[model samples]
Target: MLPNGDIVRQVLLGEKGVCETVSSDALVIDMSTIHPLQTDALIRELQEKGINMMDAPVGRTSVNAIDGTLLILAGGTDEQIARARPILMCMGNELVEAGGPGMGIRVKLINNYMSIALNALSSEAAVLCESLGLNLDVGAIKVMSGTAAGKGHFTTTWPGKVLKGDLSPAFMVDLALKDLRIAVDVARKTGAPLNMGIAAESYYAAASQDGKGRQDWSALLNQVRQQAGL
Candidate 1:
């Protein structure tokens, strides 16, 4: 809902009572990874108009989205969720009802925060290893095949690109940094001490500042490589 920003509003306004009238017929399940604050307002407004709404933001990746193997975190009423299950089942392998309106977004933010943070740390470590004269090379064949340690987005598809110095956008570094920034804001509000989150955000910040913002999150490794002169 919020992640799409004004886009959702445009849809609702465009359809002429679609947002208002559709509630009288079908359920509205929001899958955007928008701000938690915006989600709450949208849910409340739609619910008041007799709409059956659920915030079910997705996890996993583009590959998962295509494979229907995503992990779904949902927030809405039990009855509404029961109405949503049939739709959700087609899109995800695992679906957990997080809580009410905002929980789905909250969980999504934290999940992204952790993922982006880890990628930053992992890239830093890989670079650190290279700097220490650790044969970080891993042989051209292995690099061509990609490394298992890259994990998640880095899997077979991405690390090879990183190793070969191609920083295309599977998931934009700017977007990852945005999520991390939001997570840091959430942590501050909740009084959570997230030292790694802070550090991860900083690394991404520096990477983005260096003009790799539109590249893949894996581009963080470039910073490591530059520092190691590898």
Candidate 2:
């Protein structure tokens, strides 16, 4: 079962439910974008039940999911994951075996930190370009989609969505905050400082509290606008 972990609390529920419902011998692959601690807890619960659990969180867009071109990071026993590789292959073009159990989620946490950081950078760039009357949508598009530094999906879509005030949830603000929280936890675990992550999480938390939790992450621009009294 594909237990999506884009939201912390919901992702936890999904993981737990799947762990409880499935047979002990069943292979449970959790692809949620949630915290590593949550994933670790779920994995432990599954292991106690004799269920094979792997943190196989997905990356890339929904279109990628539909097209079977997602990038998957998998964590589990080398032997267990070897058996599960075919299933992952069906859903993704790249299935990276990221060492033992929980490592997949750990890696995804770091990946999300980078994504949130880049998204913040992208929003600032878009705002700057707009302020400068440069209309650099096309250029930003090229830069964000083309540059290694701008590889995240938010750069591919969020700017225009923000400009048009279309905050519908392809991915929502709450989910983004959940991922940010996950990144914060990872930072704490590694003893790494994350000033930018804290700022971004605060922004997302504000957006969520503003009743835009279910709205698309692009709505963060509106939050910024509202704060600027625009």
In model 2, the Cα lDDT at residue 143 comes to 67
Model 1 residue runs over 4 Å out of place are: 1-3, 13-17, 23-25, 137-230
Give the alpha carbon lDDT tens digit for every residue of 1-230 in model 2: 33444453353345575544666567777777767887787778667777777778878888998999999999999887888889889999998888888898888888888778777766655654455455676656666667533664455666667666777788889998998798677666655556667888899999999999999887888898899999
Error of 1 at 82 (Å): 1.2
Off by over 4 Å in 2: 1-24, 137-230
**TM-score of the candidate numbered 1?**
0.57
Model 1 per-residue lDDT tens digits across residues 1-230: 34484776566545664684574866787888888787787777777777766789999998998999999898888887788888898999999999976798899999999789776665554544454455665632246235434545445645567767787887788998998888567656655555777877888988889898998878888866766788
RMSD of each: 15.7, 16.4
TM-score of each: 0.57, 0.54
Q: Specify the poorest-scoring 10-residue window by lDDT in model 1.
A: 139-148
Model 2, position 55: C-alpha lDDT score: 79
